[model samples]
Target: MPSSSGRPNNNLLRALSAQDYELIRPHVRCETKAAGELLYRPGDHVGSAYFPCGPSLVSYEVTDGDGRNVETVLVGREGAVGGIVSLGFLPAYCLIVVKFDGPFVRVPIVNIQSAKDRSPSFKNMFARYADCLMAQMFQSTACNAIHSIEQRTAKWIAAAMDRTGENLVPLTHDQLAAMLGVGRSYTSRVLQAFRQEGILTTRRGALIVDDPDKLRLRACRCNEAVKEHFDIVLRGVYPEPDDAAVA
Candidate 1:
């Protein structure tokens, strides 16, 4: 459900002043989307911006020459995806997919552009979010190059958990492998090791985090780095697990 103020449960929207929020509130629509929904493909013109609400999640993926779709960044309630900083319709550079099933707030790009044109502060806020988004991509690239697969796996799970505020991540081994740009066998081995250590357990189509602290212990600092950047750039916009659920 939407909030009492008729806003979606998106932190970026929540961060906007009442006056600025009203500029676009009347134009926004909230809807639930299932996992595996494709929001954008490379070269496609971006028509709308999506803000994941509640436990919903979205990812930017790039297909490598080997035909592997590697995840670049995950956006949850804390951010928006598509033509975020662009002044007008622009071609998407990556494949954007829904990673979790939940409610999302969709705003046509034209409405957003109209709102931005009316309020410089609103535009600045999104520009800062875009900076934070870029920081995540930068850190992810460095992590993939320097961290071991085991560490990366833990970090990925932790990142997802933080965003959804849930222990169970709805992802299959094959899905995880594709996101990590690795083979299913390699992902299975890392998961097996984590299971043996009592950190997490794998279900038919999900991974349950048995102990978040232990999982964090096994993870690299990439997630933390991104969170820190978000804090500095968009202080109260970053979602925390304890944040109240919108109804």
Candidate 2:
């Protein structure tokens, strides 16, 4: 059973042996995170690490001068966001946004570093998860550059479903547009097309995916490739369904 700290809700924490979890458990604090919360901003000092629990989702945002952030990676209960590989006094290079609402376990980076130093297995696990993160970032870049918006949209939906474990996505077109770094009008049209084909329904600032299989079929192969890499590197530390939940 998980203690009051909520550490066991996250896959990475669960992957640790009983002894390893005890090393970090004392340092972890569970906190509620609302949707749209900016956990880390560009150039901000790293304060702590967050492990999203359950349906909580976070996205890494890469921004340019236009001021709109393009989401590069989507994180779920399967991983931790921010200050993972860093040790001390590091400034965040990318923004971290919470895309879903739930509890998160935060541990001070200093404590995390101390835990890593003492536990060789803990260090190795984090190192492998870091590799998985980098792989997701690279694949997202390639997918955005080469795939159509429609395909990417399907992939995003499929990925979200995997994390949230629900077909109803609580997001508006404008929210998705900002995440995808596209125009609201364009996203609306694309969503409308999706509705027309009986793939999904968009209304009242949320989307209901009635046909996940069809949506997955429409999505680009990028998410699958990322999952394959996770299979090799982190295995169960990543989301592995007989289906897909993202990387």
**Candidate 1 local Cα displacement, residue 126, angstroms:** 0.5
Name the regions of candidate 2 deviating beyond 4 angstroms. Answer: 1-7, 241-247
**Candidate 2's residue-wise lDDT over 74-139, tens digit each?**
998778987997656689999999998888889898888888899999889899999988999999
- Model 1 TM: 0.96
Best by TM-score: 1
Tell me the lDDT of model 2 at 232. Answer: 91
What lDDT score belongs to each candidate, Candidate 1 first?
Answer: 0.89, 0.84
Residue pairs in candidate 2 whose N, alpha carbon or C atoms collide under 3 angstroms: none
**Candidate 1 clashes between residue pairs 3 or more apart in a chain or in different chains:** none
In Å, residue 83's CA in model 2 sits off its true spot by: 0.6
